[model samples]
Target: MRRSRLTVVGNAVALPLLLAVLWWVASADSESIYFPSLQKILGAFPETWLDDGWGSSIIVDGVPSVARLAIGFASAALIAVALGTAIGLHPRLRAFVEPILELVRAIPGPVLVPVVSLFAGIGDGMKVAVITLGALWPILLNTIDGVRGVDPVMTETARSYHLSRPRRLIALVLPAASPQIFAGMRQGLSVGIILMVISEMFAATNGLGFSVVQFQRNFALPEMWTGIIVLGTLGLLASLVLQFAETRVLRWYTGLRAADHES
Candidate 1:
């Protein structure tokens, strides 16, 4: 197990290092205005992003982007889980709700940003709404599936023992469904990040996405690249956070699976 863990870690580190080296070597002598060398891009990263100090550009730009993502992602997760649980408990409600879900799902998320902007306007609210709406579907569907997929035997046993609804939920349903719920949340995080940028790109005065677009229009290619790198880094960090949370939350599930595998 230790060896396997080490191998996973080593592979993760090695692939990125190899890719970075390849990028560095391949772009070392490139003179294209659109595609600057990796060295130039790296050189520009500090001044481009950090500017006068650590907080200058990041304060104006990065904070809002990250904030929007967090708020939107959290809002979506909570709402989805709650609604999903309710719907999963009622077959009639699910039948009605699913048609609406399918209709909305057919429309792409980016299109909703402009429509949402019309009502919410081009403010933080609008951006957050866009992110929330975009990230909502995956989580909602998965939570519903997870809740409904709880073992019938387990549920029947709980009912036979006269377990209250809340007790059953607390002791059984959520635990059984958590793996799927977490999977949905992971996907939702990615969607939220994408929508964060897309919403800002569409209409915003200050944000990482807006800043990157501004850099592009002004031909600040290196700065644009730096903005992208920052976005990628944020994504990596967010994923790591989710992974840690999942590992802790589902430690019992992991142990059970491991023991079964060993048997």
Candidate 2:
């Protein structure tokens, strides 16, 4: 297991290093203002990101962007799981409300940015609301499916044991449904990131998205690229954190799958 993990880490580091080397070679001595050399981008990274002793862009822009993503995604996941659990537990309720859900999910999240801004007024509330709205559907739908698809035998067993509703939810339902829930959360995380940027694109100042756009408008290609790099790094870190949490939360599921594979 340790060897396998080491190999994974090695591959992750090696691929990016190889790509950076290739890009450095390819763009060396290039004079294109639009696509600056990777070297120039790297050179600008510290100054742009850490402007004025690290309180300029990264601290101001990047932090809020990530905070919005975390809040929105976490809220979406929590609300979806709760609603999904309740709806999945009742067949009639699921059937009745599903169409409305499908209808709402059909509309793209970006389309609602203007609408949301009207009510929320172009503040952090607007951005967070947009992110949450955009991130909500996938997890909500997946959680519903996960809960509904929990093992029937396990459900019956819990019933026979006369477990309380909360007890069953904690001991059986959630565990069984976790794989699907994680899948949804993974999908939702990406949506949340996209929305974070798009939400900041309009009527917002002091966010990573705003900074990136400002850089581009002024032809600060290196700084724009740096902002993108920072955003990408944020996404990577968030994904790693989520994966770590998933590994801990679903350790039993992982072992079961491994055993099945071996068998």
Give the alpha carbon lDDT tens digit for every residue of 116-224 in model 2: 9999999999999988888888998999999999989988999999999999999999889899999999999999999999999898778888888888888888888
Q: Each candidate: how many clashes? A: 0, 0
- List the RMSD of every prediction in angstroms: 2.2, 1.8
TM-score of decoy 1: 0.93
Clashes by residue pair, model 2? none
How well does candidate 2 score on lDDT at residue 248? 79
Which pairs in model 1 have colliding backbones?
none
lDDT of 2 at 214: 86
Maximum-TM-score candidate: 2
Error of 1 at 119 (Å): 0.6
